[model samples]
Target: MATKTDDPKVLAQNRKANHDYFIEDTVEAGIVLTGTEIKSIRQGKANLRDSFVRIQSGEAWLINCHISHFEHGNRFNVDPTRTRKLLLHRTQIDKLFGQMKEKSYALVPLKIYLKNGFAKVLLGLAKGKKNYDKRQDVAKKDAQRDIDRALRDRQKY
Candidate 1:
């Protein structure tokens, strides 16, 4: 048996959000998780696609994230895609709410990682990228890859 550090944990990730949004800033927040939920997460059975954050009544919540129930979890298992609450300070919530009011800023979950035996969600304040911006980013990545390939090839000479 491995320790928590070696625990196969990674509940969910939002890969599409990264592709569609330009991540401006990120914040790590604690998630309200249940026993069975934790088991499922440790098994890597969660999805963060289509999830978004909404602040209401001075609290932040994550919506549309799907954390599948553990197979042997029985009746105690909760819904997979339940709206989960996020733990954050009031000032941070207020600041995020203000930024969300802007037309471009959107809330996105970057990754889920286990820290100190607790589950943590890495959230991002993102701005949607225009089509051209995405194309330019792709082109830049391609160019960088080419440069790396060229340098590696040079090393062989």
Candidate 2:
């Protein structure tokens, strides 16, 4: 069978979440999708940026994610940015809800990948970083890069 280049292993990712928050914990969650939605995702047309998870009435919901319409779906395609449900265990949902009650804690989607013919999202339990905190992280990364470069140069000499 011929493989399609569009069937992305990691369909979508949210890189900004790392820079904006301190991820304390992560959870893998199954996502609910329509036929067309899954096809669109497989086409690498999904976006996880600006998406977030929320627990309401004991249910986990994914909001603000966008999955492009399938070209051949026609009437079967749903809204690209519609809210979607996330599948998680009851205890897990409860725990997340409690954690979310904290002022600084937020739920962010780190990435989404196709596993075993299913779509799964990596959710991050993150605490928002302050402006100075972000600056410090940037500085630390810069320092690390400089150190690595120096080590490489020393090895070459």
Worst 10 residues of 2 by lDDT: 1-10
Best by lDDT: 2
TM-score of each: 0.91, 0.92
Task: Note the Cα lDDT for every prediction shown.
Answer: 0.87, 0.91
lDDT of 1 by residue, 1-157 (tens): 7555645246678888877998989998999999999888888887888889988888999999899889999999998999899999888898888988965598889888788688889999999988998899889999999999999999999
- Model 2 lDDT, full chain set: 0.91
lDDT of 2 by residue, 1-157 (tens): 7454545378899999999999999999999999999999888899988899988899999999989999999999899999999999999998888888965589999998987778999999999999999999999999999999999999998
The ten-residue window of minimal lDDT in model 1 covers 2-11
Q: Which portions of model 2 miss their true places by more than 4 Å? A: 1-8
